[model samples]
Target: MEPVSEPSPDLAALADSVREIEHHVGEAGWDGPVRVFALVRTQEMLRTEPGLAARLDPSVLVSAREQPWHLTSVEQEELPVAPDLETLLAGLSWPSTVDGMAVSVERVVLPPAAEEAMPQDTDAALEYLLAHPERQDVRLVVGALRDGPSWCAVRSRANDTAEQVGQGPDLVPGLVAAVRSTLD
Candidate 1:
């Protein structure tokens, strides 16, 4: 098989932004899932929403007139919190040929099996966890460009790991499929 190509500069930037947001939300104690959608540009968008067309680059418009252009949207909607997140995600639908997505999920931290050794006080347990590098909460963020690159970031209760960004369908396969399902 031929080697996979790298993500375009635009997708790379979007992934970086997603990672930044993930870190910020994790620090703020957000232990819920967040989904970010990417809106693409189409000729119909130009006609139905003239203001959108006006804001777009001239070259982009010209290119879009021939084929849909992947213009990432700055606006995103946070879906309502649900009991079954996967079911909720599976129910979403999006316009045709939309491009790109970012998803961040903050898992609730569970005390290790050795909890009996730690202080019973919640505050003290938390402090102990922070003081011990081996025990820390973790948050993961995944970003994807439709039919393109995908990147991921992992953050701990104490610090963010060095980013691991790359181009591949396998980077975050399940998340990518979840996001792609919306566009379909």
Candidate 2:
């Protein structure tokens, strides 16, 4: 990695350079092992306060990140290619650092069919999904509005029976945990 020597002389040009770096990285793909590490020294030197970091949007970070193998959901959408569930999970708006790599989750919307599949009888399908953990990872957060039909949404990490929309079917959280507990 190139050491940070000094800020660039041309501010506008430097911004453009960063943009290109992001673009090229994204054009690559996420294939190899991943890791994410935050350098305290660098953060301290840059004076990135905790509040600022908290306020920063994970979507922006995820959007700019690069993986080594597959096209991100965002990229596929931009290409107008419909992406499957696996692709969407790989690109959701959660910041992850694996094997010193960092990527953010931008959007985690469930697909139309999946959302519709959310059973009218809340407990059964959700229970089934929980029963089979493998199925959980493949599903997205698509559900109907509180009073409306199914739509797409990101299920909460905290609640299961309560989806983000009104009182629609529950969206399970923490796939591994839900499976472990339910299966146990």
Candidate 3:
């Protein structure tokens, strides 16, 4: 394996933003709908819409102005109906105003051994996954910029504590790619 290296400022910001998003989503507990967010430069957003300051917490505004690398995530309210997240993300396109995008999705993961007994039908497969002995419920929060780095954070239901969240650039590659696609 390659030696670990220090992360760049932009990448560090991405990681912070991704983990922040994960924490925000975790507050609502589990079994929630898929959520998507638009990541924008905190300073840019406040500059473009000064009135927004009235509704934001003072600490948030302070952080935005103090930390140039701080990112703001705006939850999307109206999402187009799609069968699955991959397809939904595949068709999404973000405006230039948005620096990046993030998504929170819950999935059931099973070990390699469980794959052999998976059912063929979609419904059956989902049931099998949910009922598996070694199943894990995970919430993946991934973000990517238009022409910059990407970040991912994974939190398992069994260990939903803030300190238990795992993070990496490529932890969830497929979701990271989808987020990047929206930026393009």
User: Each model's TM-score, in the order given?
Assistant: 0.52, 0.18, 0.92
Give all candidates' CA lDDT scores. 0.59, 0.28, 0.88
Candidate 3 total steric clashes: 0
What is the overall TM-score of model 1 with all chains considered together?
0.52
2 against 3, candidate with superior TM-score? 3
Clashes of 1: 0
Clashes of each: 0, 26, 0
- Cα lDDT tens digits for candidate 1, 132-172: 64554666666656566666666665554445322333455
Clashes of 2: 26
lDDT of 2 by residue, 1-184 (tens): 9896642222222222223323333334322111111111213322434454455356533433321211112121231122643343344332221101111222233446666666678688666445543332211222111111221222223232222322112333342222122112
What digit string (tens of lDDT, one per residue) describes model 3 on residues 1-184? 9999878767877788888889889999999889999988888888999898898889888888877877888999899999999899997898899999999999888888888889999899988988888999999999998799999888999997988999888898878877888887
Runs of candidate 2 with Cα error greater than 4 angstroms are 1-111, 131-184
TM-score ranking, high to low = 3, 1, 2
Off by over 4 Å in 3: 1-6
The worst-scoring run of ten residues by lDDT in candidate 1 lies at 160-169
